[model samples]
Target: MNEYQPQEQLQNATLILILGILSIIGCFCYGVLGIILAIVALILAQKATKTYAQNPEMYLGYQNVKIGKILAIIGLVISVIYMCLVIWLIVTFGMEALQDQELMQQRLEEMMGQ
Candidate 1:
């Protein structure tokens, strides 16, 4: 017969929690890393849940897994939104810069009597 292991369950939960936190941090600094970490966190959280199910006494582990999953999802969503916003800002500013350059050139030529 197999015995339940609280330490192993807790360890898995901790791993998931760490991945989730890393994912959130990555979201602010790097989108690709954030998405990858979030995905790994999600998978680890699921594994932790299964471990908790096998050992019903590990309530702390179960709670950690749940929190990890939530954090992972939040990180992934924020990363995507952040990337989109960055792209939008870049495009908007690029167009504005081009227009400004054209205006400046026209003014310079006018001043030069050309």
Candidate 2:
């Protein structure tokens, strides 16, 4: 006689996936939000990976965890790049130029030697 057991869904898999997607979208918010979200998603994914590894046959949705981790890494990289760009812009153009369109244009023109 044999019995069958249902597999359980990996914990935090869906949440990790959602957070990863949000991290990518949030990069437009000056990159800070995206970086925060991505870091959280990655941490959650790590926990989920460990859970899945403990009992591979007992859990499902490991793929979600993997995909989420990949997305989070991508988001983190993009967010860092964006943040660096923002910092560079602030340094080159000045924070006040960012607050004023005319000032921004003037700064851009000056930078371009126009």
Candidate 3:
């Protein structure tokens, strides 16, 4: 039996990598975009990973998938942490913290005092 091989690339590999990079950068935007993009990238990468595993010789972009997965995970973790911080701030300081400087100062003083 004879097999064919060529210097080519895998499908969705570049996309996954791009999405992962974007997600990491976008994490600064309150992490909403980052989280969304990271999740999408990760889902796509999983599919690509399965495909690659099935035929390792068929793809040339597994590096993209691997790096993308790692970046996506990091982005997701950062986003989750940012989200949690937002939620904690809202819960601990209340919505007034965003609107009232006096209230914020009072809350800060109260916390410091305690």
Number of the top-ranking candidate, with TM-score as the measure? 2
Give every collision pair in model 3: none
Evaluated against the true structure, the overall lDDT of model 1 is 0.76
User: What is the Cα-based lDDT of residue 69 in candidate 2?
Assistant: 92
Comparing 1 and 2 by lDDT, which wins? 2
**Best first by TM-score, ranked:** 2, 3, 1
lDDT of 2 by residue, 38-88 (tens): 999999998899888888999989998999999999999999999999999
lDDT top scorer: 2
What is the C-alpha lDDT profile of model 1 across 1-114, one tens digit per residue?
Answer: 988755544557877878888888888764778888999999888776776777667456677788889989988998888777767645645545435877656655675894
Worst 10 residues of 2 by lDDT: 1-10
Segments of candidate 1 deviating more than 4 angstroms: 1-8, 58-60, 94-114
Models sorted by lDDT, best on top: 2, 3, 1
Give candidate 2's error at residue 81 in angstroms: 0.4
lDDT of each: 0.76, 0.92, 0.90
Give the alpha carbon lDDT tens digit for every residue of 1-114 in model 3: 876787468789999999999989888887898999999999999999898888798779999999999999999999888878877888899988857999999998998999
Query: Candidate 3 lDDT (Cα, whole model)?
Result: 0.90
The estimated TM-scores of all candidates read 0.64, 0.93, 0.86
Q: Better model by lDDT, 2 or 3?
A: 2
